[model samples]
Target: MTTRPLPEAAFRVLLSLIFLVSGATHLLRPEAVAARLDGAPFAHVATALAPSTSLVLLAGVALLAGGLALLVGYRTRAAALGLIAVLVPITLTVQLAPEALGPLFKNVAILGGLVFFAAHGSEGYSADRALRLRRARRLVPALS
Candidate 1:
C-alpha cells in the first residue's frame, strides 16, 4: 500500500470520525441519547438550557456540521470552535467523574486536538488552502 503523506489532513479525518458517528447517533436516536442526560452530572442545567431532545438535536447538528468541515479542513478553526461548544458541556456532564477517568481523559485529548485546529487553523491539504490557492490563481491571471 502507498503511504499517505498528508499527516494533517489524515489527523483531521481521524479526529472527525467520532464526531461524525456520535452526531449521527444523537440525531437518529435522540430519545435514547437524551435518556442518558437524566443521570448526567449537569442534567438539570442541560435541560434548563433546552429540553433534552431539543438539546440533543442542536448538539447533533453542530457536531455533524463541524465534523464535516473539520474532515475537509474547511473553516477548520470555526468548526473546531463549534465542536468545542458541543463537547464542553458533554464532557462536563457525562465524562467528568472519578469512575469515568478513561473517558474523561479521552475527551480531554479530543479537546486538545480541537484546540490545535482552533489555534493553527488549516494545514496545506485543506479546503481552506485550496480555496485560498484558487483565489490567488484567479488574481494572478487577472493581473497578468
Candidate 2:
C-alpha cells in the first residue's frame, strides 16, 4: 500500500489566500473598517490591539508576505507561525466580542488553519521538495 504525501502545500495556499484577501480588504478600505470599529464594543481593544492605520498597513504587508510564502511552500512553517502571531491577539480582543460572534467564527476558522499549517507545512509539491531534488541531483556520482 502506498501512502500518499499530504496536501500540505495546498493547505498553506488556502490559508494564505484567506489571509491575503482579508488583509487586502482591510488595508484597501481602512476608513470603512475604522468606521465600523469606532463604535464597536471592542473599539478600545481594537485601538490597543491594532493601534492605527500604520499598524494595519504593516499587518497587511505581513499577511501578504506570509500568505505568499505559505502558498509557495517557502518557509511555510515560519509564515504560518507569523500569521498566528498576528491573528491570536486580534481573535481574542476583537473577534471574540459578545456581539460579534459571526466574526468570531471566521477568526476561529482562520486560527484553526494557522495552527494546522504551523504544525505541518507543505510536504508535497513544495519549494522544499525542489530544493531536496536539487541537492539529491548534486550528490549523485557521474560516471564518465
Candidate 3:
C-alpha cells in the first residue's frame, strides 16, 4: 500500500493472463485437462483424492475467480494466495515430469509472482487502494 503506480499494476495484469487463459481452457474443456493427467507421475495422487475431471473443474473455477480479482487488484493478496493454492497442486500433479522441465520452471516463476503479491498486496489505481482511502476518509472525519 505504498501508493506506487504502474509497475505493480502492470505486473498483476501480466501475471494474470496465463491463469485467465488456462482457466478458460479448463472450464471449456475439463475432460481434456483430465486426459492430460493420464500419464502424469502424480496422477495417482490426484485421482486418489478425487476424480480428475472434478478437480480440473474446481481448479478452473479457482483460477478464473482469482485471476479476475487479481486483474482488478481487488483483495489482491487473498486472490494471489488463492491462485497459489490452485497452482501448487496443478504443478505437482501435471508439470513435474522429466519431459516437462520447461513447464515446471514456468510454474515456479508464476509462484514467485504470486508470492510477491500475496506478501505486499496491491497499490495505486486499485480497488484495494480506493477502498482503503475511502475508509480512511470516513474514519478521519468521525474522529474529529
**TM-score for each candidate, following the candidate numbering:** 0.92, 0.79, 0.95
Tens digits of per-residue lDDT for model 1, 1-144: 222438777888999998999899999999999998877877887898889999899989989999999999999999999999999999898887688899899999999999988888776588988998899999997898
Candidate 2 lDDT over 54-88, as tens digits, reads 55677678877887777787776798899898787
Model 1 ranges with Cα > 4 A deviation: 1-5
Per TM-score, the best of the predicted structures is 3
Go through the candidates in order and give the C-alpha RMSD of each one to the true structure: 3.6, 3.4, 1.3
Task: Go through the candidates in order and give each one's C-alpha lDDT.
Answer: 0.88, 0.73, 0.91
| Candidate achieving higher lDDT, 2 or 3 | 3
User: What is candidate 2's local distance difference test score?
Assistant: 0.73
Candidate 3 per-residue lDDT, tens place, 113-141, comes to 99999999999568998999999999998
In lDDT terms, which candidate is top? Answer: 3
Q: Candidate 2 — which residues are off by over 4 angstroms?
A: 1-6, 49-51, 139-144
lDDT of 3 at 126: 81
Where does candidate 2 have its weakest 10-residue lDDT segment? 1-10
Error of 1 at 88 (Å): 0.7
